[model samples]
Target: MDIKTAAALHRLRLASIPEALSFPALLIFGTGFRIAFDYDALVMPLGMLHGVLFVIYVVLLLDVWNRTKWPVKRVAFFFLLAILPFGGLYGDKVLKREEAAGVAAAQAREEGTVDA
Candidate 1:
């Protein structure tokens, strides 16, 4: 892939991490606030925050999928991870691994150690 495309994918991957992690944290905090303190008002704002983050996460995921040409199963797995609690953290780890591998491959190509 070209440098521009690789850079875009890397940005998308980085952008996804916080949204993925925040959504779950908000969900937990929202639920806890509602149940423990009867602060139902907290849910509305938290839900909205989560909803926006979820949308961003999905958009980034789709962008990454298109750029990376990931398999359907892999894309679906990442989508599923978005909805599960703490799944974003796991997704971040996976993305980091993929990023490292992609960088290594790109370096190899640049060094003429591997043919495209």
Candidate 2:
């Protein structure tokens, strides 16, 4: 995919993962509070939002994989990361580095200064 599309997708990917992951984390924490201190109220909205963001993240991942022509392993890792709490953070950093490298290479090509 072009760098602009890639950059946009990457940003969406970053946004979705954390929001999705936070929902579950918050639920767990809230549940703990309810059980430990009898402070139950409602957390369904956060859960629903997280679920929605997770779905969007999946769709975005597919689009990114298609556009970037990523290998099956790489795509799998991307999906797997979303499921784990901290995986998204790691994936975000890696994706940013990859995207930066891609932009640099593209610039090099445009300038006709890239090494063969």
Candidate 3:
């Protein structure tokens, strides 16, 4: 990949951390809040927030797939993680590990130890 693509991927990886983690948090909290408190007024705003977050997550996931050209199965796996409770943490952890590996590879390339 080119430098620009690499940079974009880096940004997406960082961005995905919060996006991956927040969807489940929002889903769980919103449902729990509605059930326990039964406040229709608050539920509206909470639902809206959840909708917004879900949209953002979709967009970021699409960007990741587009940038990396990852297979659909892998993308679907990440999509699945978004809806599963606390699965976002696992997604975020995976991204962090990828970032670490990318950094190490880049460093190796910089030191003339890895092929370009």
Each prediction's TM-score against the native? Answer: 0.80, 0.77, 0.73
Summarize candidate 1's per-residue lDDT along 55-98 as a digit string, tens digits. Answer: 88888888877787889999999889878867777777877777
Model 2: lDDT of residue 49: 66
What are the clashing pairs of model 2?
none
Q: Measured by TM-score, how close is model 2 to the native structure?
A: 0.77
Model 1 / residue 101 / CA error / Å: 1.0
Q: Note the Cα lDDT for every prediction shown.
A: 0.78, 0.73, 0.69
Candidate 2 lDDT, 1-116, residue by residue in tens: 34665575567557755754675587687777778888666456656667777787888888777778889999898888888876787777787877777777767766778763
Candidate maximizing TM-score: 1
lDDT of 3 by residue, 59-78 (tens): 87787678778899999988
Worst 10 residues of 2 by lDDT: 1-10
* CA shift of 71, model 1, Å: 1.5
Q: Specify the poorest-scoring 10-residue window by lDDT in model 3.
A: 1-10
- What is the full ranking by TM-score, best candidate first? 1, 2, 3
